[model samples]
Target: MAPPNLPFRLIRPAPDPVLAEAVLRLLETPEPASEALAELAMRDAPFTLALLSMRPLQPGEATTLKRALTERIDEAGDALLRAWLMHTGSQQLQADAVGQLNMRAGQVAETAMHLAIELRYPRPDEAYLAGLWHHVGALSLLASTRDFPVLRDQPATALERRQAERQRFGIDQIQLAAWLAESCGLPPTLRDALALAGAHEEHVAGAHPLARILRAAIHIAGPDATLDEAARLTGLDTERLSNLKTDVDYLSTEGLKSLGIGAPGAAEHERKPSGYPMLPSGWRAVALGGLLAGAFEGIDGKRLSLRLGNAFRLLFGKTPPLMLTVTEGQVQPLPMDTAQVAPHLITELGLQVDDDTSVVALALRTQASTSHFPGGDGPGRSTRDWHLARWLGTAGILCVPWQIEDTPGVAVVGLDEHLDLPTEEQQLMARLVSGAARALAAERTRRRAMDQLGETLMASQREHIRRVTHEIKSPLTVIKSYLGVIGQRHPEDPTLATELNQVSQEIDRVGRLLGQLAHPESATEEPRSTSVSGVVQELQHVYGEPLFGQRNRELEIRIPGGLPPVAIPASTLKQVLLNLVRNAAEALPEGHRLTISSPGVLITDGRHSLELELADNGPGIPEPRLHHLFEAAESSKGGEHQGLGLSIVKDLLGQFGSYIFCRTHPERGTRFNLFIPLAKPA
Candidate 1:
């Protein structure tokens, strides 16, 4: 008989005690071997399902569930697997019943493998999985319902057993299994095979090939008197069928041996309770409160919903509560974007606030805690309550109303029907929800403030750029006009005219760069490559006199002919060379020299690049200063210097897929090596 108000929690059963112990031992190692864990996982049905449910299936994954699960086990790594094992291991199972069920599942799985091999089915592994999990619904029922073991062990036909389950629990094991398979997002073919495994022989004739194999294997390995029917379904003769049965029996015995389950005497001795003892209620509440406080301690605005869900998980153990947001009298789920809550739930649980039938709606209306059960009589109880019980795989639900400072909402948690919470625990849940709402509201306020600050900063930056652009353009216009005057006056001198034209072109390039700064979105033109030889000659002509000649420092250019063009515009390359040359000249003494050279091509990661070296014979930079040489700081040269030269040089080179490296010693002067990518050929 069904226990009164059975909890009907849809929990995956724990793994076999022997297997759990073995897995825990492996997890205790510094690095657990994935292959070893996978081998054990394949032998246990609940453990395999738990591993698969941890991750969604990838596109173009392996066709069979067994292969897919093997991949998932490797991907999950040891930490996640260990945590899940510990969580499930805390819930103990009745040893005799679990052992019997596990052994039957193993036998059925082995038999399915043999049948698929004989029939030459394409996916024999998937057939094995279908057989192994065929009785998962019964296992789940056994885990949640205290009196389920008697029904499971009773002597009855498969159909009669299903009828009994439906009568007692309002739903049969087959329905439960199908629902769980759907929830896990199992492949359609495998889901159909699992759902159809318990159907009658006639009902499964036209089913999937894996379904037929699973059905035949169940009949062969079970205690039902259907050996003749199994033979007719699989087209196997009497002798082969007998041999198959004998081999499966031998294999089942070997499987038990591998699991360390000896004969009855040793097996009974090994069947100790695997779960830990529960703490006292007061201590448990304190521990839970501490955990919840930690969950909300440093809530990040970006990850507010994730932290909230975690806090709820701490409050309500394995089954976390579902959260809904209320907005202007319209209620919907928190916008977690299908990652936290399944999509189907979002569709089904949307309710109007004035709908008198929903407990969730009533909680919002009265702004208090409310609850509903399957057979309860109240104004708030309706068909929707029954539907929610089935969908959540629970017998009842509790709705706790919360508000984000005047915006009211509700938190709905699935409850074990048999669980009776003390007043203190209920009050603790209310306080936890209140704290979560406050955290969320504070996060919202923080985000709004951050958004406003960002807008203000952007406006200030734009204004600064506009002022800087206007101030720099006036000087550039004056320089260009002055150069034009010099060019016209020196029309007879070709050398002077060329120098004036180069200066004019540089002034125009600066103007264009300033325009780009003001409206960066419009700067979409492709970058141009600069000829290294040409840029070197232009630098010598433009800044050779003022920077080095005026400072009594010698400048040497040692570039080879026929070097490839680098991936930077000529104007940008000139600016970079000017910055380095000016810094070197300023740091060098009266007679110190700077040597600029192109040291051939470099191959890095299969790409060709040009290496440019600027070496100086000035005093070497101190070690402390060299470490942060490129960072902007107070200028060691003081007067009119902002120490932005090297920093700007670094930023400009990075924009063109180039890098800068420095090396120096106390005796030897400093060297800056620039790696500039060679431009692609047109």
Candidate 2:
């Protein structure tokens, strides 16, 4: 409901149909340039206001509306501009009323530019802007009231027309236009020009230069003002004024032609029925419900809101309703595919739910639908609501609250000030909200179920690992006890005693490895420097007897003296060397020799590294097998061999920033090279 003192609702003026069609035709080209769009936007006051209203303003930044219009067109690009134009052009106004207003604005704009040049005004462009938008209040009145057209066409002076406007609407066009300029945060100079442009001749004569220019331009552009009267008002010679009038008339006529208004059949074409038929209420509800169901199919929790927003747009058209998510007392916009709202604007437009005078806040507190018109003369209007209206680029807002289980939110729908929301439409909106809420709840439930199943599987895997560790530890304990008994019984032989101690050390290593399997999170060890020669000597002692001596194969080591230590743990390096030597010994024939050598320090990838090679003269790996040699595969050696030796070797080398590569030829032999990084000095 509106205030009792207000005679009519205040709404944004509908865009001129001719100008809108011209812009639409421009957009029809495969790629419409933004410069052309900016020029078109500057010509129409309503289009200019719409563009400036949607642009996000920085705090304390002083940007003129005309400059901001060009910046926004360039930033928003073609797709968003087309969508906004299509949405704004959908609303129909009286064709005659729109045409009359457009022509008047054009004539005033041209006349003002000519007058500013003659008077040598400092800001001629601003003078033109003031002239073009001085009549904006009339457009608003036409949109807000039915009888404004009759009042607009009266054959009276400017003062008489203003008096009649004040008597009927309790406010004149100048005041309304001023208020709109203030709401858009236009510069105070421009606002003052708009506010005082319709003053009496005596008052405007002593006013600011822009106000005086606007008043004289309006007079010259009027139907009844004579050339002599315009010259007297501006203090110019009649001959000069007549020449300016001729130019203004020609320019205004050209402007009208460019807008497609004076062309043949343009008026008749605009007068036809422009509204599309709508479906019945029940069918609309069913259609929306079907779409909402499809939105939820195969969608996870993360994408549920995005898909729901898309469904809302598809059902409600381009000027779709906005869905805002409420969390921790703040409201935010839901994600959408298109950039309907810019990211920076979203950050600036976020609202608090605790605000007392906000209708959106009221909707959230009471859990009901609410509407507000920030441009109206109602009592409880807040500055925040005014800012929201400007940011949304709408005259009115409708807020519908929704809740999904524990989460509560609101859906903000843009509305025209004079358009009342029907009961059936409201009901359908409620159904849409309810359907979206239910989908959200279902998605939440599915996510919780999946989390629970993952936890159960992880627990089962941990328990199986524990049982396997226990079984392996039993055999390891028995082997250690038998080695202890043999060491005690073989003390008479020093060589045998030394071998027994080596076996005991290997058994302890197996025990430590078993402990790591049960507690894998504690397996990481700090890196340490190991002597390359020391690790090679230890490998020869540990595996030489069983792997090479028992197989009747020769082992050759060619480590140079004074080699730098490698940046790997001693235990880890020993384990890697043991695996490689064991593999070579098993694969080589009875008398084949395995050679382990270090070719000294070499620079690799801008780092000093030790080049270690293990070469064997055995039958080289087949080409097909060598391609996937490092991958874990079935063992050709059979019988409990998992064939994971090369894979494990690669993984261990990677953990220490080392690299390994193999070159094998069936005729020549096979060689494995390891580039181990050298340790840096402490």
lDDT of 2 by residue, 1-682 (tens): 1222346655455456657766767777887766677777767777766655555333332334356666766554444454344433433345456546755786787788789889987666667767777877887787657877888789998688889989999888888777766655656776787777766667767777777777778777777656665676688987888788778887766766766555212465544332223455566556545644454556564555544443343223214456666667776665443434664565576678887878888888888888888665642476655655556666777777887766777777765544566565565566566666676667768878999999999889878887998998898889889887987887788887777777778877877777787778888674689898988986777788789988899889999889998999888888888888888897898989999998788998899999999999999888988989999998888887899999888989888899999999896679999999999987
Each prediction's TM-score against the native?
Answer: 0.55, 0.52
Q: What tens-digit string does per-residue lDDT give for candidate 1 at 508-618? A: 778888988987888767457979889988888888888889879999999999999888988778888889988888888898899999889998657799999999988
Best by TM-score: 1
| Candidate 1 to truth, TM | 0.55
Q: Model 2 segments beyond 4 Å from truth?
A: 1-279, 302-361, 369-400, 411-441, 521-529, 602-608
The root-mean-square deviation over C-alpha atoms between each candidate and the true structure, in angstroms, is 11.6, 13.1
- Give the Cα-based TM-score of candidate 2 against the true structure: 0.52
RMSD of model 2 against the true structure: 13.1
lDDT of 2 at 626: 95
Indicate the worst ten consecutive residues by lDDT in candidate 2: 56-65
